[model samples]
Target: MNSITLEKWSDVVLPIPARYRAVITRDHKILFHETDMTPFINQDQRTFREDFMMYQFDGDNIISIVIKDMPFPPTHFDTFTDGTLLLASARCVRTDDWIQKNAGRYSLDGECLYKFVLGDGISAVAIDDEDTIWAGYYEEGVYGNYGWDEPIGSSGLVAFSSKGEVLFRPHLPMINELYYLNIQKANSIFAYYSLFSAIIHLDHFGRVQHSEIEEVMEVGPITIINESLITYDYHSKLLWSLKKQEGVYKKDKAFALKDQEGNDLYSEESAIRIRGNWLFVLNDSGIYRVELTMRMLEE
Candidate 1:
């Protein structure tokens, strides 16, 4: 069996542990949500739940992260610029003041602010090249004949402007359920959907690209490593890679195997961000690095 090597980075225990939803702005930044059991005491019958949290870093020091305040719990958050933060939850959108006393506020006009409620919640969000907001639906579906339905039904990929105007909503294949989706930089967007046993890619227009399994890796969490697409599988517990180079694409299988130094070739339950020949995979345990190679798959 071929083995992949994964070296330990940092296992800094987070203040509140939660599911590793997805990472944004590469391994340099990450986002997660924590729910507090405190019930809303107001007459509105709203649950006073603390939803989202973002951990910021300069290298590995964890410079800043949004924590819970008194009445409101941070729902979802993303750093659009070094000074600006776009934060959200299920009901409302707000801009966080980095210079202020951590007050969750929006400088944008209130008339421009709209109630952006998601189906399950705002799964993933990205500002595309056109300054449009690309939000991925946070839902799942079953595979094969027993259950071949997606959670959002026809709402696979949805696009909106900065002012919260719904721009484009397109449907994907009925069998394909969204797994992990995000915007690559701003020019091109990537969406992964499970067609039961396999995964496929959908462009910004919600059009399915190459459906062949050999052409793309199966549905799992993915990261952009330079020109390659990397993913980790929890079931078989293996790591896979696919390269989309100058008009050509290829695939490679990676796993955890020990070298002379007792390091792993890859990581488990981690997020990988690849640039050039270097790959960075990080989890609660911390970040790791690996060298990658690209070769033509001979027929």
Candidate 2:
């Protein structure tokens, strides 16, 4: 396997654990949601009064803002093309009565614009070119036993317009777990469901174009670089290039990631966001920015 070197640019240790999700916005802002575990002192004895927090960073400085009007904590979030923030909270054991108003959009100043309710739970979401939002819902079973068994119910994908209008909703089969959601430059949306080891691709119109299933130990986030679909395997620490061939996504290239001192960089439970030539990785330890150089091979 080809090995790539990762030079750390800027590292920031979050005040709270950012386990839910993380992404770099279009305007070069870093945003991450603190997990439900960080709010309460004790998990067993809970007050249920704590609200989830979303933190933003511009360069290396943290942006300070007091969010007093948020209904619920955000489990996953992404910034719209127009700088608005879209937030979603999954229905889990940690969620309480406030979860009824789980999904919504907020301004950069921490003001809520619109709020909506989701049935099952939202695991991940991404915004497309036309400002359409694509969301992946997870079944209750997936949360049970840490997604060991197949998803109990059939929860699917949903698309919403910028004006908070439901554009389309498609029901999928028993998805074990929806790991992440991403949109390519061509406006095609891609979602990773770990239970079946599948990646479902939807076109700009929210139509299913293909469902590619492969046997892999672990799957993380998916990002499109130069029109190529790239995904990381947490177990192997290998970056794979997925190419569409024969109406399916096939692994084309693989690269192993290593730190400056040649130590293997473990990607377990890590989230990745691509901005220009930089790739941001967030894990339990800290946040890291890697300058990436894509090498083209002869066909």
Candidate 3:
């Protein structure tokens, strides 16, 4: 096992209760969403007032903040090639008469570019190099439950043009939670992972290139670094490399996380984002920058 170093600890101060999603723009700007929920019980009908706030950061300084009030909470978001924002909002509760007007394109200044409807609940979104937007949906199973323990019904992956036109919608298995979506720019493939340990790869044309169902692991976010899948295991507190061999993923490496003094760093509610060669980690303690150094094992 390789040892890792987490240095340059910093704090990101935001006004929201918790962070849901974060992304680094091409220009090194940090865009993130913060959410807060309030429960209300009225005549046995339970509902929540979900507040979603958007924030932008330049280094450690907060540049802008936008508190948005909408019919549903923003579930996933990404930036277009032109720096425009794409947000997907879906109803949290299962309602029979719910319409699917759940996604929107917006400018950085909080202006709505376009609004459109999807077939199911949108969980994650990504923008390809050609400016095409890809979205992942979470459809409830027969039990009328969206939890992972329930059966998986029918979900889908969608590709849309920048003009809000649906380019293609592919049939996919019911994903429990679309945790992360990324574009492997090397092959122009859009890839996404779900909480159910399913990884789906799609070409730029929205055709399925490969799909793999692996053993359940506590992986938070995954990124393709140099064509290899890199993700942090929440249970082991180690960074793992998954390389494809013979149409399956093989464990390439494992790097254990430690502080400068060699103390183990663990957190269950941590989030990770990779920019260039550095990995940014945020947990309940603070934000940290992790650098991985590999050393050959000596016989």
Best by TM-score: 2
lDDT for 7 in candidate 2 is 62
Better of 1 and 2 by TM-score: 2
Query: Which of candidates 1 and 3 is the stronger one according to TM-score?
Result: 3
Which 10 consecutive positions of candidate 3 have the poorest summed lDDT? 40-49
Clashes of 2: 0
- State candidate 2's TM-score: 0.74
Per-model C-alpha lDDT, please? Answer: 0.45, 0.60, 0.57
Please provide, for model 3 over 1-299, each residue's C-alpha lDDT reduced to its tens digit, 9 standing for 90 to 100: 67677874566633334443666554445677655434421212222234355776666677554535444456566677787777765333334554335567777677777766543455566666677776665544222342323222234466777766787755655445555565534235445545446666665565544545354557755665554667777777777877777665556777776667776665556666654345676666566675432332111
Candidate 1 ranges with C-alpha deviation above 4 Å:
1-22, 32-54, 65-76, 81-83, 90-115, 119-122, 138-153, 197-218, 223-229, 242-252, 257-260, 265-280, 283-285, 289-299
Per-prediction TM-score, please? Answer: 0.61, 0.74, 0.72
Query: Per-residue lDDT for 127-235 in model 1, tens only?
Result: 6545566666434412211122322224655676555566776644453445555554543566655544333344556554533344533445565444566665555
Question: Model 2, range 1-299, lDDT digits (tens) per residue?
Answer: 67666666456655434533457665556787655544533332222334455677876677644455455556667778787788765643324332244567888677778877543456666677678877676656244422323322234566777655677755666555566776633255777776556676666755555456443546666765554567776676777777777655677787776667776655546655655345566555566666555563112
Cα shift from native, residue 20, model 3 (Å): 4.3
